[model samples]
Target: MRRVLLCLALFFASPLLANSKTLFLNGVYAATYGDIAWDKGDWRGSNFSAIRLKAGIQVVRIDFVSLTLGFQKVGFYSGMHKWSGDNDIGFDYRGPVLELHLFPDAPFGFSFAGATGTGYSYLTSASQYHYSSCEGCKIDAERSALKVGEFTAYVTYKISSQLEILAGAGTRSVKGEIDYDVDRGGVHSWEKGDVDSWKESNTMVLLGLRGSTL
Candidate 1:
């Protein structure tokens, strides 16, 4: 009985005792194209540029499988031409990620990882429009909750113990509604608009720079 209890304890504690934690950062560029519909009509066929930053920490690793938690920020350029004065939108997705690595012991390795989490979307735009005789005097800003998902499959070449070069294709999708407020001639109005289900799936090349021991 004593030996069995000791074996059980060791088995439960092995992962914590032997696991190595890793930290990585990546920069991503993507092209986004999607369709959106509003109360007026179908606003179809729009494309824009996007930039994203991903930072993660691998908290648990058991052989070829690892679990990480990451925070990502993505910015989208102006796709709506009507609101084209210094306008951009951003989303934040932060949550746990899971990865599967093939050839974990080799210098050349491949891995696939995916993440989904809580997200927030923000948009800021300025335009000159006539709203009830308020010509050229309206400014709009929007904020909303977004649902975000990301997936990446990459091949890695380890240049050193702490650095790797990664080339991969990634897909990210963001969907949400925007609650916007407009200010025109000192009067305020509120309206709701949506991203109308936007998905950005593009090819990305990234560099994986690992941090020192944490």
Candidate 2:
């Protein structure tokens, strides 16, 4: 009887010690909205919303949690608004990221954390047009993909053992050809190699919540 009781105590204690490792699922919602301006002061408003999935690993979780690494993927909605000929103006985007997190505890009983990461994004657009008084002005127009690299940072809080939240901002610098196809003279082409890209490098806010079993 004594031996059985001792074995049972050790079994429960072993589980608590081994449970130091945890896996969590996280979801993030983001919005990017801004306007574009040209030399003639032509401005237009554009905005997009995206969703992301993330998985994290806690390398160290003793005393104060030390390190965490994660991967996330984001997708955006961009489609044609109007079509003049075969030409249309539309948008499509995708981004992939790698992130690292660090947490520090303060004496006043408040906890803080910072996250930094790198990501790559790709975008494609199409446009078409016809004469105001002409008919059957058929055109098929598309552009080569425009790609950019981005970096982001944020401050975070831990509301409880199972919940966490964050708020922050980031930027993206683009480098690619601004090539377009048109039907004015039967599809004219030009290699506009990096002639001041459009719609990138904007400030953003991030809000996230995470839950897990401890």
Candidate 3:
């Protein structure tokens, strides 16, 4: 029993001890702009904002090369207005990120990194539309969904040992189906079946800060 307990304790403690060797964490804020093209619909070009957080191991010499896993949240102000007009809709996405960075050893070092991930895209809005051929009669409804695939590439400047700033561009692609129903004044109307599979690819520019514990 004593030997078994010792083995179990060491097994759990091994990861914690290894994690103490080196830790890296960073955060970024950026603005993105580009075009979102749809296969079965129209294309939209717009600007968006994002915030990212990363944590991983240094794995190499300080500021040299490292692999990090992170998460980013993006907000789109008017990207969805083109779909449903005057609805005051909001669009956003959140996802897991994987990044690789290579930094040269210098004061004004220039670094390059690329990141990619998959996430969910959310849309919210309220609007009224004509129900069937009823005169002056309308129905109200809301819509939303989950999307996938986001990619980015960036160039960074190392200002100090623990801080860096970066600017980059990236794109997000999503395809999904949406369906809904509407009710008008005690009368129920169903808009059944798949409306249309929408495919969107948004391009954006990002400017953000990265701070770390080296």
Candidate 4:
């Protein structure tokens, strides 16, 4: 019946951030995906696509604790070769995050938070398999930059009075080191021997929306 009467008018709608903004510009955004429940961290149990662009607007709210400064990103190939879409094992992260929110004025607005961050981790490949043994050169398709750390937990829902409805789940622990020339026909090769020790800890899922103004 119309989704249970819009969940009974937001379950007796009223509190969508009851009162608290003393310098809190919470503007969040979210979209996420996950898999690799556990595969010795070699990820790609299909896809663990995470596109989370968080926001707490570097907050400060003293009543119920809100000290936020947000940002989280986990990436994977979609373009830039590997046949117009890449993935043999891909990873990337862009970070700067900090969060601490409890309560957040509840009313079907269950909020809980804990976040951590450390940036940059990009690796892309499958660039023509290095020309199948250097039959032809001039390929240059190896990209590298590593170092990642992330921790996450969030569940929010306010749905009104300036909107807030988010979904959550997380894991992005892509670690460093891959300094190899690997015959540069395609720039870098895994060959899985030892690229100075590679790593991956993927498992993510997220959904998002955030808006607030005082």
**Which candidate has the top score in TM-score?**
3
* Per-structure clash totals for the candidates: 0, 5, 5, 0
Write the candidate numbers in order of decreasing lDDT: 1, 4, 3, 2
Q: What are the per-residue Cα lDDT tens digits for candidate 1 across 70-181? A: 4443432221222222435544445555555555446777867787766665665334121344356554666556776768776766675434455566666556555556
lDDT of 4 by residue, 1-214 (tens): 3533443344223224233333335533221111111111234233534334444443465675555564544442331122223455454454566665555556344344444444433334544232344434433333345666655566665666555665656565655554323545546553322234456678655665555321
RMSD of each candidate relative to the true structure: 14.8, 15.3, 12.5, 14.1
- Candidate 2 deviates by what RMSD? 15.3
Candidate 3 Cα errors over 4 Å, as ranges: 1-47, 50-63, 76-88, 104-142, 181-194
Off-target runs (Cα >4 Å) in candidate 2 are 1-45, 59-65, 78-98, 104-146, 176-199, 212-214
lDDT of each: 0.45, 0.35, 0.44, 0.44
What does the lDDT read for residue 71 in candidate 3? Answer: 47
* Model 1 bad stretches (over 4 Å): 1-87, 124-137, 187-190, 193-208, 211-214
Give a tens-digit lDDT track for model 2, residues 97-186: 444444424211222222333332322222222123223333343333546454666555557543445455565444433443434456
TM-score of each model, in listed order: 0.53, 0.44, 0.54, 0.30
**Which candidate's lDDT is highest?**
1
Residue 198, candidate 2: C-alpha displacement in angstroms: 6.0
Clashes in model 2: which pairs? 87-127, 87-128, 88-126, 88-127, 88-128
lDDT of 3 by residue, 104-183 (tens): 33444343334344433333332323223444544344343546576667666667655556676666676644443455
Q: Quote the positional error of residue 211 for candidate 3 in Å.
A: 1.1
